[model samples]
Target: MQVMKFDMCYICLACFCIYVSGCERSNNRQIAGEVEGERIYLDEVDGMITNSLYEYLFAISETRIIAANELINLKVLKIEAGSRRISVDSLLSMEMRRISMQETKLKYIRDNALQGGVVDERNPFKLHPLDTPAGAEILNNSYQKFLRIRLVDELRVKYRARILLSRPQPPQVDLTNVTSHARGNLKALHSVTIVSDFDCPVCREAYPELSKLFERYSDHVRFEAISLSSSVTPPILFAECAAKQQKFWEVYGYLYGQKGYDFNIDSLIAQFELNREECKSCLESRDQHKIIETDMNRLRQVGIEVTPTVLIDHRVYHGPLTDKAIGRFLDDLFKETPNPGN
Candidate 1:
C-alpha cells in the first residue's frame, strides 16, 4: 500500500491546466478523470493515484511518462523483493556493472579502430579498422546480448518478475520551422534535434558527443542543432551567418571546440576561408538573430528549461551527453519499428 507522490515544482502550471481539461473530457475512462478513488494494481499491490501524480503524468510528454512508469515499476519490484527476502539493490548494482563492462569493451574497440592509420606501438589502446575481418568479427559478436538475456532469465526465475505496464508511443514533434544546422540523411526515420547554446559550457562539451552520434548514425538518423543562448549572442549570430555561406558545421565545430568563451571570429573566418566581407556583413545585419529567438521561444513553449537538450524520436534527454546513453535511446526507438532506417 506504500505509494510514491509526484513533485509539482518541476512542472509548469500551464501544463497542469491542460491536463485538467483533458481529464474533464475523458470522464468515461477509469483512471483518467480523477486521481481520488482510483488505483493501479501492479503485482496485486495497489498504487493509489494522487492528484499531483495525475497532473505530473498529464503534463509531461511520452518519454517522461515512460520514465516515470519505469521508476514506479522499480519501486513496486523493490517492495515485492523485500517481501520475498530478496536484495533488490544488490541485484540492480550487479546488472548495472555487467552492462557497463560490456559498453566499455565495445567503446575501447571502436575508438581504437576509428582513430585509423599507423598503430602506435607504445599505445596499447590502438585498434585496427572495424572493416578488418578480426575487428568485424569482434564488433559483430553477441556477448552483450547473451549477458542481457542471461540476466533477464535469472531475474525472472528468482523474482517471478513481469512487466504488466505497456510503454506508450512517444509524441511526434514538428520541426519544419525550426532553424537548425543539420547533418545526415534528410529522410532518415529517426530524428535527433539538439537545442544548444554556444555560450553554455555543457553545450560545448555535448557538441563532440552530438557530432559523434551524427557520424555513427548519419545513415539512420537525421541530426539537427538549434542554437539558443541567453549568455552570449555573437557566437550564435556568427553560426547563423556562416550557415548562409554553407559553412555552419565548419564554424560550429570551431566554436564548440574552442578553449575559451571569448573566440576570435576573424581567425575562424580565415581558417575556414569564408568571405570576410560577407560574414562581417551578416554578423552586423543581425537578421539571423531572429531565427535564434524563434528557436528559443519554440523550445520554451515545449517546457524546456536547459540548454544542450536532445530530442531523439521525440524523447527529450538533457546533457552532459554520453555515447552509451544516446546508443541506448536509439536502440529503444529502433526496437519498436521494423525498418529502423525508414
Candidate 2:
C-alpha cells in the first residue's frame, strides 16, 4: 500500500509543503505550440486543459494557496524569532516543546497513513514515510512535525497574516437528457444537477438537504439526480425505469430511506405507489439499464468520478452535498448574476 510516508525532512519546506507544482504565470497570447504550422496560444491550451481536466487546475490552485500561506507563516516566524534575539531553529525548538504527546492528532495520523500517495514529485524534498516501525520512529517524529505546523498556525494569527488566494472555478458543462427526474422550478434561473449513488451512505444523508434546496429555492433553482452505483444494480436500473413514470424521486427517497439496506420490492411498490407488474417488468428489462448507462456515460464525460457530484450552472462540486457550502455558493452566484430581465 502506498503511503504518504512518515519521514522527517529538512525542516521548514517539508513542514509547510511549500512546493506547489503545475503553477505558473503565463502570457495568454504567447505561442505555446504549433499544430501543422498554425499557431496555438497558451490560453487555447489552458482552456482545453481546464475543460477536460479541471481537477488538474483545482489541485494547482489548492497547492498554490498552501504554499502562499506557508510563505506567510515563515515570514511571521522569522520576525518573531528575530524580536526574541534567537536563532529561528532555537525558537522553533522552544515553541515545539509546548506540544502534548497525548493529543488526538496521533490517531488522525495513523488513520490517514494508508491514504497518501505521490501527489507531485516536483519537489521530492517532502516525504510521507510508511507508518511501519521499520519505516521511521513514528510518534516523536510526526509529533514534532505537527508541533511545527501548530506553531506556524499560532504565529500566522499572531502576526495577522492571511491568504487571499481564490480557488479555480470548475468547468461549466451544458447537460441535456442527463436525467428524466429533473425537479423544482423547471424554468428557474439556476439549475443543479446531482449525479450520485443512492446506496452511498453520505449520499443518503445528503438527500434531504438537497430536497430542501429544491423546496427552499423552488422558484429559483431546478434540481435532478442521475443515479449511478458500482457495486449494485437494482437501485440504479430500477430508479431509471421509475423515472419514466415521474416516480424517480419517490424511488430515490425510498431507496435512501432504507439506510444501506438491500432494495425491497414490496416496500418500494407500497411506498412509491409504483405498479407492481410494470415495475417488475421494467426492472427486469435489459433496456432499462441502457437508460442508466446513457446517463452515466453522459456524466463521465464531464468527469463524474465520485458519487454526489453537483453541477450548479455547469461547475462541478464533488463529495457529499451540504447546506452551508451550497447555500453560500448559491448566494455568491446569485449576487454575481442579477435577476432576469433586470
Among all candidates shown, the one with the greatest lDDT: 2
Q: Please give, for residues 1-342, the per-residue lDDT of candidate 2 as tens digits.
A: 111221222232233222212223523356779979999775655554554444544445455665787789789989999999998999998887655444455464566563352111354555545454523454445556777888888888888886666655665775765754677777767778777786677778788788777767767777766776663377787777677677887777777766666568777767778788888888788776776777777776655667767888768864236776577567656667744742
Cα RMSD, each candidate: 13.0, 11.7
Q: Give the alpha-carbon lDDT of every model.
A: 0.63, 0.66
For model 1 the TM-score comes to: 0.56
Give per-residue lDDT, candidate 1, residue 258: 79
Clashing pairs in 2: 4-128, 5-128, 5-129, 5-130, 6-128, 6-129
lDDT of 1 at 106: 56
lDDT of 1 by residue, 171-216 (tens): 4556666677778877777778888887888888777777777778
Q: Candidate 1, which segments miss by more than 4 Å at Cα? A: 1-171, 318-320, 338-342
